[model samples]
Target: MINSNDYKIGRIMVGASDDDVRYVHEADNLPYYHIGSVNGISMVTIDVIGHEITHALVKKTAGLIYQYESGALNESIADIMGTMLERYMLPNNWNWTLGEDAVTIRDMRTPEIYSQPSRFEGPGWESPGNCPFPFLGNDYCWVHTNSGVMNKWFHLVSTGGTFNGQNVNAIGPHAAQQIVYWALANYLQSQSTYSDARWSTMAAARDIYGECSNEHRAVIAAWNAVNVISPVCPGSGGRIAAEQIENSAESIMKVYPNPATDFVTIQLFDPITTVDLQLYDMTGKVIKAWNTKESTITFATKGLVPGIYTLKAQTPKGIYTHKVIINQ
Candidate 1:
C-alpha cells in the first residue's frame, strides 16, 4: 500500500512533509489526488496524478491558460500526456483510456458516459453544443470530457496509434508528443482555439524538422484526417495569424524533439559553407563548438549536461541563435 511518505507517480517525487502531495484512503472508497493540502483537499488517485502531472508540465512550459480555449488546450493536452504516460511508464496500471480510473471524472470516450452531459465537461467528452468552425461539427463537448476527441486525435497522430480507420503511426508517439508540446508552448498565440491545436503541433514539427521533413507531412495528413486545418485554424473574423513562415530563415537552424532526452539533432537552417557553431552555458562560457561547411548539420550532444544553453551559429551572412535544453 502506498503511504503519504512512500508513493511515487511517473517522474514526480514527493514526501508527506510537502503539502502539494496528499492522498486520502477512504474518499469514494478509493484514495485519489487533491490539489492543495491533506485534509478537506481531495485525495491523489493514480489518474489524478496523470492529469495533475499534465497540468504541471504545461504550466512549466507554455504557461497556457487555466480556462476557455487555452483551457480546452490545457485539458486535452493533460489527457493526452497523462494517458500516454500511464501507458508508457506504469504499464502495470495502464488503462490506455482517460478518466476510466475515476468515478467522478468524465470518461473521454463517451460523453454520454456521464450524466452531467455538457460538452465542456471534464470526465466525459460530449460534443460541445456549439463551437467555432473547426469544432463546429463538435459533438458541445465539455472541455475535459470532450477532450477525448482531441486526445484520440493525438494518440492517432503520435503512435500509428489510432482508431476508426486512421493511421496513428504519423510519427512516433515520443516524437509526436514532443512536437505538439513545443508547438503549444512556443508557437501558439493566446487567442488560439481547439482547431489551432493541429496547426500549432504541425508548425512546431516543421520548425524542428524541415518543412520537407516527413514528420511535418505526416502531421498534416493526420490533421486532414480529422478535418483540422493544415496551417492555422481560422476563428471568428474568418482567419487567425498562425502561419508557417515561407522559406523560414528560422528553419535554417534546427533542433529535434525539444524537451530532448538524449542527443539533439541540429541541422543547418541555411546553406552557409563556411560557418562556425558554438554552444554556451548560462555563465557565457563556450562549451561546444563546430567549425565546418555544410547546409545540413546534426550534433550528437550526448556528453552535454541537462539545463539551458545557447547555440550560436555564425556564417558570412551574420549570426543565428538557437536556445537548447538537454533533459536528464
Candidate 2:
C-alpha cells in the first residue's frame, strides 16, 4: 500500500479479467489501479503503471475535466509522464513508445503510426463535432486521439525534430520534463484548453530558463510544430495578453497585503454584480474560491504554506490575474 498526505492508493490488482487496465477513484476516496491480462500476458509494465499513477497525480493537482481539449490534455500528460518514467527506469533501453512491453498503444516519437494526428487538424485528427454525446463516441471528443498532438510536441521538445515546417532544438528529456511538469503543476487549470496550455508552457519555460533562451525557443518551436500556435511572438515578453482586457492608465484589479502572513484582500476598480474568485497554489491546485457581488473581499490565509500563489477573478469584462505571496 502506497500512502501520502494528499492521496492514497489502496490496491494494485493484477491479472484482472478485463480487456484494459485502468485507475479508479472509488467512493471511499481512495485510488486503485488494476492491470489486466490478455492471452496469459499481463499489462503491468513500468510505462503502463506510470500512466495510471500519473492520472492520480493529475486529479490531485490540475483536476482537468475529462472532456474535449482538457480531456485530451489529461491523456497527454499521462502519456508524457509515463514515457519519462520509463526512460528514467531503463536509461539504456528507453524508447519513446508507450506500452512497448505490453499492448504498444501509443508511440510518442511517431504518433501517426497509431492513427493519431501529429499536428492540429492534420490527417487522422478527430473532430469534436462528430461526437454528439460524450459517452457515445471516440474516447470523449477524441481525448486519446488528440493527445497525440501534445505527445508529438513532447517528443520533438525532448529530442530535436522538424515537423510542419518548424524545427525544435532538442532540450533533452530532463529539461523538457521540468518545463512541462512545472507548467502542469503551476499554471494549468481544470478548464484550461490547448491554447491555455501553449501559454502556460511558454510561461513555465520563461520562468525556468529566462526569456529568449534556447529552452524557451525550443518550447515555442515545439508548440508550433504541433500547430498549437501562441499569439505572443518569441522574444516579445508578452503572453496571451490578447485574451485579457486591461486599461492602459490603471489596473482593473488590486490585491493587497501580497506578502502577508494572515490575510489577503482583493478589490476591483469596476465591480460587477457577480464575480467569481479563485485562489490557486504554486501547484495550480485551487485553495479557495468565492462567488460574490461585493467589490472588495478578504480571506484568511492562516494555514497556507508560504509561497507565491495566483489569484484570478472572472468578471463580465474578462478574466484578471494577480500574484500573491505569503510569508509565515
Candidate 3:
C-alpha cells in the first residue's frame, strides 16, 4: 500500500548484499530503506532493523534537522525507539545497548563505556572539537556522542535511578515510551534543544500522568539527574534540597495586607529552605523579583499606581499565588 500521505510505509531497497551494512536515505522527495549483507550472521536482528525504522519515523514526526542539538536529539530518538522495540519483543534477551549481536555498537545502559557523557555537564554543544563527521561537512555534531544524556534519561525513566540527590520511581518502559513519543510528535520542534526536550517530555508526562502524579515527577527527576533543566517546567529552578517543590498542604504560605498602600509581607507557616517571590501587574508583567531564604520577606510597592497585582511564591512546598491590591 503506497500512499503519499502514509509515512509508515515507503519505498525499500536492498543493496550491497555482499557487504555488511544498512542505512536509510531520502532522494527526490522519497525515502528508501537499504539493507546490506552481514555475512548471514544475525542478518535478521530486529534491533538493527528497528533502528532504521525509527529514523523514518523521526523524519516523519519531528523532521529533526541533522545538526547540533536537534541532530543529536534525532539520533537519540531513533536509538530510544529502536531499543524500546527490541526490549518489548525480547525482554530477557535484550539489554540496554545498541547493535544487539554485532560487537556492541553503543551501550545505552552506561554511555560512559563509549566515552559519552551521561550528564550534560560535559563540553558545550558548540565546541568545534566535539563535532563528528568532519568529512560530511560537520553535520553530525556529536550526535551519537552527546546522545548519551538523553539515552541515560530514558534508561533512568524506564528502570528507575537515583540521580542528582533525587530518587526517581520507575514507571516501566510502557509509560516512558508513551511520554517520549508524545513529546516527539507534539512538543518538540525542528530546532528544539535539550531544555526544550525536558519541557516537552514533562508536558507529555503531565498530560498522561497528571501534573502532580508520580510519573510526571519522575520525568522531571530523570532529566535533572542528567543535569538537563527545563526552563518552562513549573518549580524548576527554585528547587529546595535538590528536588522540585511539590505542593503540600502542611507548608502554607500567607500574604498579608491584601490592600496595601506601600508594601506586602510574605509569611510562611513553616520554615522552609528558600522561596522565589515574583510580583506581577494585571498585564502579567513582572514588577519585582526576589530570592529569599528567610521565612518571610516584604515586598515594597512604592511609587506605583493604585491597581491590582499578583504575588507568587515558589518554594519546595509548592507554588502559591495571591492577589494584592495597592491603593494610594
Candidate 4:
C-alpha cells in the first residue's frame, strides 16, 4: 500500500510521470497530478489528498464514474477539490499552478495557460504536449487534460478571479469544495459529462445551498465564463443565500447591487479561500453560477433580461445564501 505520507495533495508521485494525478493509497484518492519542487509546491502534494479524496467521496456519495460527461465532471470535482485543498493548506500568491507549483507545471486559475486553451482544441484528441492519451473516436480520452478548463474556471469562479471585466466577491474555496463534496457525494447522477455534470451540480447547489444562492450564481458564471454548453437553468428562478439574512440562522453572506444593472459584486468576512456564486430567477430556477475561489467575485448583468434574481455560494463548512436583481 502506498504510504499516505508518500503522496501530496495535487501531485501523487514525485518521479512517477505516467500521469500527473495518481491514486495514492489513502482514504482520499483520485485522478490528477502535481509537479513541483518548492516547499510550497511540495506541500501541494498534500493538497492532492483532497482532490483524490473528492473523487472517492463523489464515487461513493454520488456514484459517479470516470466516463462521459460524468467522467468530465468527476475529473472536475477532483480538480476543484484538489486546488481548494492545496489553497487551504498554503497562503495565496505563493501557491499557484496545478502541476508544477514547485517546478512550474500549470496554472490552476488561468485556463489559457501559456496562450493555450485548457481544453484540447479539436475533436482529434492527439496532442503534442504532455497529455498522454490520444483522444480516440472523438472519445474524451483527454479527461484529465481537458479538465483544465473547469480547473481554471473553478479557481477563478471560486475566488472571484477575473476573466473579462467581471468583479466577484466570491465566498471562498473551503465552502465551495464542501458544496461540491456534498454534490458529488449526494446529488449528482451517473453518465454526467461537462454539461450534464454542471446541470446536476446546479440542482445540487440549489438543494444544499438554496434556490438563488451565491453558490448557484457561482456555478452558472463559472460555466458561462468557460463557454461550456449553456447549462439549462429553469427560466423562473429564486434566491438561495442572503448577503445579510435577517431573523434567521443563515450565515453572513454579502453581495452588492442586489438588483444589479451593470455588475454584481460579492464579498465575505475573512480572507476568502474558495466560493462559487450562482444566479437565478423567480420561479425557483437556475440562471448561471460562478466559482470564486479567491477573496471576491464579480459578474456582469449586461446580457441579462432584467428581473429579480438570487445568488448562491458554497463555502468550506456549509452553504451561504444571497439575493440580487438585474436591471437591464
Q: Supply the global lDDT for candidate 1.
A: 0.56
What tens-digit string does per-residue lDDT give for candidate 2 at 154-190?
9998899788888789999998888788788866889
lDDT of each candidate versus the true structure: 0.56, 0.79, 0.70, 0.55
For candidate 3, lDDT tens digit of each residue in 11-82?
Answer: 655454454444556565565556455554444456766776777777877787767777778878888887
| Stretches of candidate 4 exceeding 4 Å from the true structure | 1-21, 24-44, 92-94, 114-140, 161-169, 229-328
How far off is residue 232 in model 1, in Å? Answer: 12
Candidate 2 off by > 4 Å: 4-7, 38-40, 231-328
Q: Which candidate do you rate higher for lDDT, 1 or 3? A: 3
RMSD of each: 11.1, 4.8, 13.9, 15.2
Query: What is the lDDT for 121 in model 2?
Result: 80
Q: What ranking emerges by lDDT with the best candidate at the front?
A: 2, 3, 1, 4
Q: So what's the TM-score on candidate 4?
A: 0.51
Which stretches of candidate 3 lie above 4 Å from their native place?
1-8, 11-23, 26-28, 37-44, 123-139, 231-328
TM-score of structure candidate 1: 0.52
lDDT of 4 by residue, 1-328 (tens): 2336765433344544333444433345433333324433353364555656677556555666565445556766776766666666676643545544444445666645533244334232224344444354333554555666667556655687655443334757765665565455434667655665555556555545665667776776666666553333345253323222211113445677665779987766544566666665553446787766565667777777776555656666655545466777
Better of 1 and 2 by TM-score: 2
Q: What is residue 245's positional error in candidate 2, in angstroms?
A: 13
How well does candidate 1 match the true structure, expressed as C-alpha RMSD? 11.1
Candidate 2 vs candidate 3, TM-score winner: 2
